[model samples]
Target chain A: MLKTIKLGLIVTLLLPALTYAHGPARVKVIQDIEINAPVEKVWGIIQDFCSIKDWNPQVSACEITEGNANEPGAIRTITLENGQQLKEKLIKIIPEQNKIQYMLTEPNIKAFPINTHGSSIILTAIDGGKTKVEWKGNFYRSFPGPNPPPELSDEAGQEALSSFYIAGLENIKKLAE
Target chain B: MHFHNTVILFLALGTSLHVSAAPFAYITNQGSDDISVIDLAKKQVIKTIKAGHKPAGIAVSQADKRAYVSNPESKDISVIDTDINLVLKNIPVGNGPVGIAVSPDGLNTYVSDWYDHTVYILDNERLEITGQFSVGHSPSGLDLSPNGSKIYIANRDDNNLMIFDRHKLSLLATIHVGKAPFGVTVSRDGQLIFVANVQSGDISIIDGKTNKVINTVKTGLFPYAIAHDDSNNRIYVTNQRDNSVSVIDLDKCKVIKTIPVGEYPEGIDIDIARRQVYVVNWFDDNVSIINTDTLTVTGEIPTGSGSRAFGRFIQFSDLP
Candidate 1:
């Protein structure tokens, strides 16, 4: 008899299966890009909280709604070029790690996508002053029930956020570099 | 993070306990609409079982020597007799049936209908719908209490966990957790419930007795699913985007070690008797096996693309 299971991470039996979500909606969007600039240079541009407008062409105007700049509880409202208004609140700002956590909260704001409230942007330093910026968001579509409209479906929500992140990251990379 | 030498000692201790001369695992390939059965003893794929369209969730009944796979696209459950390794029938289920779980006794199976917001109960012997429970929006993960008297459903869209009385078939309580709670499992002792919030990248710990969320432990990005190992008192969480497993020491309530694995790691399970951890990487078309004691990747087995392997998936010894 062949004894295939060795003591270490039983390397042999890798069973593959898919189809678990119950047709659940795509509720998350995470994308990142590598930059040639230093971590400090990149962090300096984004850490300002309200500086998103200068780096993102989609963001037409940003106003500090509450608290001081870079504060964990500071609230800011960003108006997109399409006149969509998004209210965002800073959850935390860790300068040591060059990370910022924020959440979107408003009474009835339907700016970019539905339920795209919480987001995080982190900067990691690579070898020789290179930097990596990861912009991630956790959200769902406006329609929560079954058979969402094409614009508010899971694919639409993910597509909207993916495009937003790609555009924002591309512009930021060009400016930072 | 420094790993203790105690892991080596435990590994030496675990090697002697595995009773089976062979171990096997079944993975669901969504794109191919089939199940890939792997012979763990050989580290090779023994067979690919043809299944329905978009076969997704699978639950193995140790009591009955059968495997129930939920085919969302086909809207049916394929029951496989493990001894013969053959599909007996495709039991028609609700529309968009996704998450599936069998009672510990193997008498009943639960399948969550994604589009209907309900769970269908099937009798193991007859493969027929015996009962149904209306739940919240997008119930993804369905689990049972340690004693199998209670049911826990992780409602993905509602951001809540609905606890139900198994026999009574009535809603017990609903506890709000993090955003988009997807995967859920109850502790062995039935005291704790761990819900993986995909959107929040955290695990919400619910005290079963209180039906309240006691703590939320932050993990890596896009935590799709989790599995608990009682012997080590640790929970393994698969981070889809981070490509790592967040090992949380249950006692300390923190992520102790982040074990990196393949791309888009989704479904995860811990084989306690073997002291091994298995993760299905959705995009990588393979499963990464890790030695829990050493906290290292020990083996890799390739499978079909889009492997989700959502539920408990280890085939133990029925060897004579």
Candidate 2:
């Protein structure tokens, strides 16, 4: 019994030499809404990557840099109503598919809820001349560590994203109609 | 018959990862302020020890014989005696300590202050900040070379990997990686360094000798951390967006398999001896244990809510 105990102790000491417990970022929010407008009309309102400021009241203005307006590598510098700014690069633009994908070039503190992989605004045609627009995204909270601050926590970020998508979709419907 | 059972036990213990000689894995529950002690051989959580608030980063000093856990919200580091499984001390450091790494010699521990943008060096025995040095913004994931001569840090917001000298705490080099670079790891032989870029959904593999990104391998959405299997030259990356882990073959530089795990699998570690990988699911509030050989989840052990076992969390110890 003594020998067994000693051996167990030795084995235990050497076990966790390289074991690491590193958490990857979490929190994914995919919000979608049905817009009572034709798919073509809805896509027209949100098609231009820089035109986000026109329909989305949250964005104060947008400036396009590099490549054509619809090019995949086109960059957009957007300033929100709160003076918050972000640099985004257009990854893809599939007009036939009614899908536009853009990635966050700078996921800085100023870009809080947008610190994620590229978000897509996909418009799918419905049978009743309506469109199902998805303003979905995958992201980790701005604050990486546990017990995040109120504004940067996962819950707070999720709420902000949900509200942003809902507000944008609601306004787009009103404008498209 | 008694002697025969004892003999059988010893025989079983001789093989690595046998059911008889499995080690204890200490997992930190961020939301619950507790630690889950798991018996790998039994594939179950045997104990839950209370800890400080929001335990995030962790490291083990096998030589000093203690496990250090960084509680970012509490702004302190908790020291747990590996043999006794009790909190020995809670030493305060800079604000927002996220990533932690202990030196190979076990005399000093390095902690990254995420908010302060500095790395604090602590005296292992005294648990006092002996030194600190500034680095890039949002220093999150940190790892040390086995020789304890080099340090690597993932600057989350800066989108770069910063290398430092272990002794002088001097800036060595900064290599630009993918966006939202978080978890950083150095290979067993210190010839390779891997960084999980959360926003880019890819890994930047850096050559240890040149400190340059040799290759970028695409993974599932939001890969947070990675575990390297030295024997097979395979890397297991935990993807948060899709709730899966991508198994990458280093030799081939491609993801060969993607294993689905629980919801929001964040923190991940492996017991090389048992050939088992343990992942903490944030949303599911449990630990998913994977049989590395088969690349399958063989068991799911219930744990505290928001279980995030980050850093060197799984300590192989004798259950006390």
Best by lDDT: 1
For every model shown, what is its TM-score relative to the native structure? 0.67, 0.67
Runs in model 2 lying further than 4 Å from the true structure: A1-177, B1-22, B317-320
lDDT of each: 0.79, 0.78
Interface RMSD, one decimal, each candidate: 6.1, 7.9
CA error at residue B150 for candidate 1, angstroms: 1.2
**Per-residue alpha-carbon lDDT of model 2 for B1-320, expressed as tens digits?**
33533454455446532233337677778768888877767767766778777787878667665788888778888877655556767989887888988887888989998778899998976668889999988898999998999999999878999999998888899999999898988888899999999878999999999999999999987898888889878889998756789999999999999999986677888777678888888767888888889999998988886777777776654432
- Model 2 Cα lDDT, one tens digit per residue, A1-177: 774465345335433421221123344567788878899899889988898889888888999877777798799988977797878888778899998877776564444533454477889998889899987665555444445445556676678777777878888988988
Q: Model 1: runs farther than 4 Å from truth?
A: A1-177, B1-22
